[model samples]
Target: MWLTGLLAAAALVLTAPRWLPARVVALRAKVFAKVNGDNAITFPNAQVGPERFQEVYGHPAANGRSRGAALSDLFWYWLSPGAEVHQEHLEAGPRYDDVARTTRALLSGPADELADAAARCAGRVLDELVTGRVTPVRLRDLMVPVWAEYCYELVFGEPCPRAARDLIAGHADDVVTALKCTGLRHPARRERLTRYLARRVAAGDVRRPLPASLSPAERVHYLQGTFFNTAVVQLSEAMAHLLLALAQHPEVADRLRRDPADDRYFAHVLDETLRLYPLFGIAHRITTGEIDLGGGTTFPEGTVLCFSYPDYHAAGHRDPGVFDPDRWARVPARAAHHIPFGVAANRPCPAWRLSPLALRAATAEVLRRFTLHSTVTHTRSLPNRGPCLLVRADGPPPRHLAALGAFLRVRDRWEDVWRSVVQLVLGTVMVLHARRLRLAGRYFETHDTAGCPPGHRPPDHRERAE
Candidate 1:
């Protein structure tokens, strides 16, 4: 009996690697279903390849299709009703050459310098908002130019050209004109930029193929789009959500203000905010070949797969639909899995590092100078629709109240630790029990070989013994 038990244990240990992956996959699918319900997976018509998948929403696309058609419609509807005519000229999809260059520049810069630059930009914007007496100032409009200028400087090693700056800051028509001048058909505009880029390259400042195989015109459009998407669109949306969250959760705000340098705390706030309102809600993907997604579901090659960050995070989160930053402390693993920018493995945005730095710097600066207190209104915008923040600048709250907030935060952290410890223990027990059951089953299966009646032993077993 002892020998049989020992053999059973060995068998269970040896086979674990074979079964572990299936168990994990099943568990993930079960959890997904529990939080997102049965209709979590959707098949849209548009073929958004891996390169472009990072840009789509996780939710179902419009007209009961994938977001591909909807995005194409939006581009034409908003930018130019005649986009079809220039469709041949447009780069097949988002080009990453310039994005790579900008990211490299940002990463090479000193962290402190980047943080200081972001803070200064935020400071300048705050000053304008306060002193301009601009009632209900369009926060989006104000943030766009500031961030665009910063990004332009990073890429060009200088301030944005006066003409480009004027065009970007001007009315809607001017913005349209600026976009048009960046097309291949515009020789004068294209030639001017080509000359500028040539000079930058000659000075050993910018890299060769300054635009990376793209005509000067297309390069300008690509750079402008990339900056606007990352800085103007996503960053503004994230900032708006942060302000809204602060207004909604004053306790969080109080705690954040108490220790402005605590990057971890700020990160938790940002993580929770993004979880509640992810900038890019859904990420689209396509399978390269036949793939099994557990639960007997198999996706053939070319199938469109959409994964929602909100749904994925909410499923694992303690309370899927609540605004709780404290949860991050309790479930650090889940917090770590948070992908507000994009998936870590897949083509994550090159600006992943710089974006967070900017956010943290801007957040710290804002918390120091102002007190936010208001909700926001939602709008219909593709990719992201940051709330309209109605905020006002006020002096910091009392130090005593902040101290109380700090104490509560510490108490919360302790509670989180306790909960996590309990969970670990429970999980360990479950795993041990499962192992015991598997060992018992293995023991029974080999019982015949271990001991059998003299004549009842199978011929193969008797021969082996001989």
Candidate 2:
């Protein structure tokens, strides 16, 4: 009777997935939040909804990058090598000004020239991958190499050398894989690129000069952190989300595949893709000064504001969960609860203008050569790396997608059980290391400053009041 009771309990526990998947996911997130204790005001609450997203985001005082925060430590840990010097993380100062100017120069050129270069690189990438078979592929893996070469050419003003491409891909893949928590950080992989970048800097091979204030080693770290790491990883992830959407919606793929010239429709698809799976899950800011939100409600200095991009994009939209590109036809993308590039007043993405143009060209190149199809589970956190089948444009349609999809549902759910545990363990260790090392904290506490770090900049009325 004891054995019988034990066996019945085991069976019921095994069958809990049917009813407990959502609970498991929620519990996993709860564990993460507990591990990385935050002190921030989350957006989309009753106090701040989509209507005020831009107003709060664009507020002059809400521009602090990383100071007095716990979550910033995790971000710094993920983007090591030179997270402190990365433009996105740097406090507002002369150094940041110089770096931002240089970034603009690198992305500067004739619009047609930049667009054509992206297409050429993307076309070459397709040449190496496309075969006349319904081959299964990981979409992120495919796009990383493509963006690596594109960024290489932008920096070096030449076609990317084979060796450099491999180093870039290695470091970028390791960084992003670790970021997604599907893998661990292999420091050796990141260091190899660091050494390679040092050589390139020594050779004076950069197309544009980096900031003069930065040392040779700092310059190498800057190149590695910015062009190689963030630029490559973000574009690769963005393209993966876009392609996965097209794969799931064959009708949309057919329309774009048949008419590559339809820029209007293609733009709509990009808008909706960004809306559903925003690249940034949460963009946190440290309050440099008090923000008076009217009605006697205000956020004081040093407070953290965590902007929820996914939640904001879902607000004020009908059928927000559906991936219908046609919705952009009725609602102007500007008026919609969309901030893919972020508010202009704050630190909008440096590549804001160039990214869309390059993405549109890349999407056209991909659809021109192949028709995409996938039945894998798509989510904001695509830990499975977006499994899909790529069929040549002329190839016959494949079969057994329904079976593939069914298998994916079961596999992904089970994988989540193990993945959540891994994330919990890894996230705790990384967060602890970040806190102990005090990368950003050290900078804030020690960097030379008369009153406050000049990097933090422009004190407001609250400072004078104090």
Candidate 3:
């Protein structure tokens, strides 16, 4: 049994390179054609490639479909109210009833409230980055923890459950494993979920006396796990989109810095980025009953259906294949045709509002501070592109730092020293984490062979591997 466990562990880790991202991307691509169906639109096979993703929103177009569609779906799912069908579950119970309400309260909350909270969260980090007090690598370290904390608060509500937050903060691998298993075959998801649950329970991070509304099993599914994979996936994808825009048009950042009130410009850049590279393509639903998606194609009851928001949004814009924020600016703000998150028929993201607020706050703060450099090596995901982790490029000229330095000069010297010390300590901790992953990789390679000397080599501490 133990040897079998080890083998299973190896296979689970191996799947991360393909399985995790594919789970999200595959769903997006499969639904590219069904986003909208007015029954009047038709194309005579102009769109080519996989027949599965051909007619986006029922309008047939040829030659372009990519991960950008998925990112748009993620954006919509995270921001706006879901489609009519999605609201049904929310109405079914009080537990979920608050999902949309709380989301709206947070995003469309009082402008003062949003500004104060956003500033508090971003203040120090932005200051550090702008002043060259920390490197981009160090900024990533600070940003991930801060962003994680913020997201947990949004998802679970405040006063944020300390144990749940700590479990996520300390055991990222467990969270990643559970997320990867979400839509897989039952036993596979159950196997990974069980291990994750046991670890949290052992750490005393999960409480006893499961909620009265849940059986012990149901409680474990909903409460014990965290959405750490989504956190990293979305954050990295958002960061990439933001950076890519900055790299392509230095003027956009300049305009943003000079007139911070022009929130529309920031939105345009974000929209363009998503259109070019979405995070999760489309969301899936097994049809509960027979329904006509117009155009004379009636999907029978129980048929799996999806709507491709990315395709619809891309199709409505000019040169859907290129990266251009200007095209985004040309569209109106509340246009349903943009469908970056999810549209009327197929919205799936529960974090719709929370994600955009977070992304906007983070993006606005960063752009107002530093000029990000361009990289020759780009990262391509199933849906988006990020800076190659291995590449280093010269960032935009350093003029912004001098301006920011003058602004921060009001603080006393001692306070500045303390902040720098704290940042340095955080940087060291990140270095140690990287070292741990390196060691684990080497150890796994060394022992993963036939006839190796074996006796309890402890399952490489599951949570950190993610």
lDDT of 2: 0.82
Instruction: Report residue 440 deviation for candidate 3 (angstroms).
Output: 31
Model 3 spans with C-alpha error above 4 angstroms? 1-111, 124-143, 155-212, 215-236, 293-296, 333-336, 344-350, 376-385, 388-466
Q: Work out the TM-score per prediction.
A: 0.56, 0.91, 0.51
lDDT of 2 by residue, 16-85 (tens): 6555545656765665565335557889789877899889999999988887777777778788888877
Best by lDDT: 2
Query: What are the Cα lDDT values of the candidates?
Result: 0.48, 0.82, 0.42
Evaluation by lDDT, superior candidate among 1 and 2? 2
Q: How close is candidate 3 to the true structure, as a TM-score?
A: 0.51
Candidate 3 local distance difference test against the native = 0.42
Clashes of 2: 1
Using TM-score as the measure, which candidate wins? 2
**Across residues 1-466, which tens digit of lDDT does each residue of candidate 1 receive?**
9999999998865665445434543553343333222333443223432223333333122111222222223233223222322211131222232334444554457778777777877777677565521123334454565665556566655656646543333322222222222111223433444355445545656422343434444444444444433345556656667766786587998898899888888888888887777865554444434554346545555454555565555554556678888777777743344667665545556666777788788877777766654333322121112222333445434445444445444443343334333333443343334344442233224433222223332233234347
Q: After superposition, how far is residue 271 of candidate 1 from its true place, in Å?
A: 0.6
